[model samples]
Target chain A: MENREELKQLIARIKGGNTDQFGVIIERYQKLVAHVVFKMVTTEADREDVCQEVFVKVYQKLDSFRFQSKLSTWIATIAYNTSLNYLEKKRVPLLDDVAPQESPLERIAAEDNTPDETAEYKDLSALLIEEIDRLPVQYGTILALYHLEDMSYKEISQITRIPDGTVKSHIFRARKLLKDRLLAKYKQEDLCR
Target chain B: MSIKHLSDKRIQEYLDNKLRPESLSPDERKHLDSCQLCQGTMADYSHLYSGLAQEERQLLSPHFTARTMAIIRALEKPATAISRSSLFIAFVAVVTICGVVNYFINIKDILYAVEAFSLERLLSGSAFVSTMEQWSSRLGGNLNILVFAGLLLILVGLIDKLLVRQKANRAYFMSV
Candidate 1:
């Protein structure tokens, strides 16, 4: 979290034509940008491209930024929107549209992996992440912004442009869904460990 | 006595720390303390929360910053050039305005004045003086018109400059 004065000074320098100063801004916020991009963009190559494009957009549009929101939130909003645009271009479904035929646990358990292969990567954390990835795009994004980035509901609302209540509902539902699937798949002892 | 289980909302609020156990109402608190089912739910949520918080971030290439900067620097040059051109346009607009005003105010008089200083007119002092007097009178009578024309030209030039810069900005954004 940059203090207001520091942010102002940095922006002033960038606006003053110090191009190198923008590198510092990118470094500071790239991780936050990556979290949003990674959650929204699935492909490694496209994620990297979209992440760079987000920064490019940010740099071009920085002059118009009036500090109405935190810089990180503003950058994250760009990342989210850019990823959506990419998804749209590729004709990818932005939301998970297909209803589940079976429980998430059953779906994972039913994968064609052999018993030994499944046993090899059965970490609870990995399973939870897989479940999260299977969630609806908005749900997964809200979860990443909320839990991973430690963003507040209001900030996530700003990024996703959803109502704060909707953000809360999605997060709760997503977490509950993750928990239910994990509990169904693993014993309490294994999860705790 | 019938026992009521905690609502999912209450359990979530507890795990989210929106309502800590210490802050729970007496009944909810007593139930949470004695109810194995509620305790297990809370534990599951706690583990989920821990896993979420500890989830690893995907690292960008180590050269991500340098590559992004290189692209920015490349794009920035044209932007800087465009802005410089805009400044030049503004300067030309100002100069055009001043030239128009000067042309309206003095070009004819100066031309006549130069003609008056020719050898033929120089030999006749009274004709040169009369021409100078006529030029001053003409300027005084058309002062309002001169000001109005100058202001109109300035407004036109300003609008033109603004439109050009707007187009340039749009182009810059599109290129990005």
Candidate 2:
């Protein structure tokens, strides 16, 4: 509550044309912006640039903010849009619509060996990261923001511009997808043992 | 007795802690206790959860805020330039508006010129020649009514170009 008040006051100062105060706002929201940008923009070179671009948009559009949501949520929206636009300009299609080329189901389907028999052991985190990245973009983004960024479903919904129910559904589905992927790669008997 | 397994969603809810021991019916609890498949599924979820629990948080570069502030300062530079450009556009707009007003204010003279051009006079080559001569002499060869209209069109075009450029500048500023 007090923190929100401080940010509101600082935003008021920035909007009042005290451009110097923008630094504090950027510092406060930079992580949130980075998380959103990193999730959406696949180009490593473009991520930081898009993150900076989001803040530039925020500074310009600050006066129009209606206080409908938290300032972080608002910044996340800009970050999400800017990163998306960057991808669009690069002629990259929105990844949410396409099943990733190498989904867990596909990988398991392609393997000649049974799931339990030939477990070429890899680091669990490495496999998880690979599988997570291979999920649909929406799932990857919602999961990253939920688990990696530690955002609430409501916050994720606000940032992603999805309904609250959709946010919950995506988080649930994303987790299930990851677990299913794990289940495909290893046997239940092996895991239980 | 054949045991029916819980659906994956229900099992996940249990693993998510949305289900507690007290919440389940005794039959369900008892079944889970002996069910190897359920326990294995639970263990798989536990491993997945453990991996997720250790998902690394991405950190921005230490200078991220500074870089952003720098870009903001760069953006402000163009905004002030746009304001100056807008003032220039406004001045041209005023001039164009004054040209329109001045033209309207001389509507009476224009109407008289039109009134003088009867069909008979237009049909008569001699009358047409004389009338053309008279108007050209009156308005001067350097600036005829036709030339004046042409110049007004050019000025309006200039204003349109300025407006388009201003709109584009504003768009870029917003995009940045």
Candidate 3:
């Protein structure tokens, strides 16, 4: 956040009729934007479109972004909402309760892991990435923002608009679910040592 | 202490390092240290914690910034375009005002028609005053201009509504 002043200056320049300067904002935050967008939007083609749309919205609405939070968090909010809107329109399953949705562990348990695909994974990190992908959009997104993006619960709250407690709860539940599945597949005694 | 075990929630806070050391009572800390269950659970959580923080990030397409900038270029336009809601409000206002003006000219007829116990006169007095004879009766038979202007506005409003809805539908389908 030390770059806060510099980002403010850049945004002021963009708003002061130097519209081409918007590219710098795009360049700086596109990865963070992608981190939010990719988790919600599952389809590649639509994911690209949603990411582009998030920036378009940020550029159009940048004037209204009062320096209340970090610019990255504001851009992240836009990305998160835009991705959710895309999912709703496309009817992708997210945080739904049609049934007790299958966790990665459940699927793994159903499989005969004697020939496990995760055998190709050299470590838990790789297998964790694979499991994260199977998570619901909100679960995957919150985890990515918290863990990979290193955002605190409050920052994630500002972006995702979920309460900070709910953000932590999501992280807790997501980790617990993944851990439960991990324990089921790789028993605690075998791996937790 | 009445409680002999740390709840999963407490264990999570400890794993996240969010719990202050002072906040953890000596009993809880002792219990956690002496408890094999909590230790094993914490180790499993720590592994997940490290994996999540260390997970390889998915990279955006190399040209993602350039593509986004292109979208920004495509979307850039002067801010002078009126919004659809404003146009809708203007349409409703125009209709309301025209109905009011046309009725303002017919307050007497409405009163008389009400007194005479016949609502037909009132019904034909203003709202249905679209014909030439009705126009002559409504506008005092001198300046047909006001009546014609009101009619013209109503016509324009209807056409505007139709075209706007058509444009909106087309845009909706194209977007989908």
All-Cα superposition RMSD per candidate: 10.1, 8.0, 9.8
Ranking by lDDT: 1, 3, 2
Q: Mind giving the per-residue lDDT tens digits that candidate 2 earns over B1-176?
A: 23887666667667666458865667767888889988887787778877876765555778777666766766656656557766776786567655754654356545545655867667664466666566556554533555576677667667766776776555444423
What is the TM-score of each candidate's chain B when compared with the real chain B?
0.43, 0.48, 0.41
lDDT, candidate 1, B1-176, per-residue tens:
22898876678877777556675778898888898988888888888888998888556888888888877776755556567766776787678756765866767776775776778887866587787677657677654665676687677667766776676555434423
TM-score of each: 0.70, 0.64, 0.67
- C-alpha displacement of A46 in model 2, angstroms? 2.2
Indicate which candidate wins on TM-score. Answer: 1
lDDT of 2 by residue, A1-97 (tens): 2177787898888878898899988876776677667767776767777777788789889988878887777777888778767777877665453
Q: What is the C-alpha local distance difference test score of candidate 1?
A: 0.78
**Judged by TM-score relative to the true structure, which candidate is superior, 1 or 2?**
1
DockQ for candidate 1, C-alpha atoms:
0.47
Q: Model 2 Cα displacement at B109 (Å)?
A: 23
Candidate 1: stretches off by over 4 Å: A97-99, A187-193, B79-176
Question: How far in Å is the alpha carbon of A21 misplaced in model 1?
Answer: 0.6
The lowest-lDDT stretch of 10 consecutive residues in candidate 1 chain B is B167-176
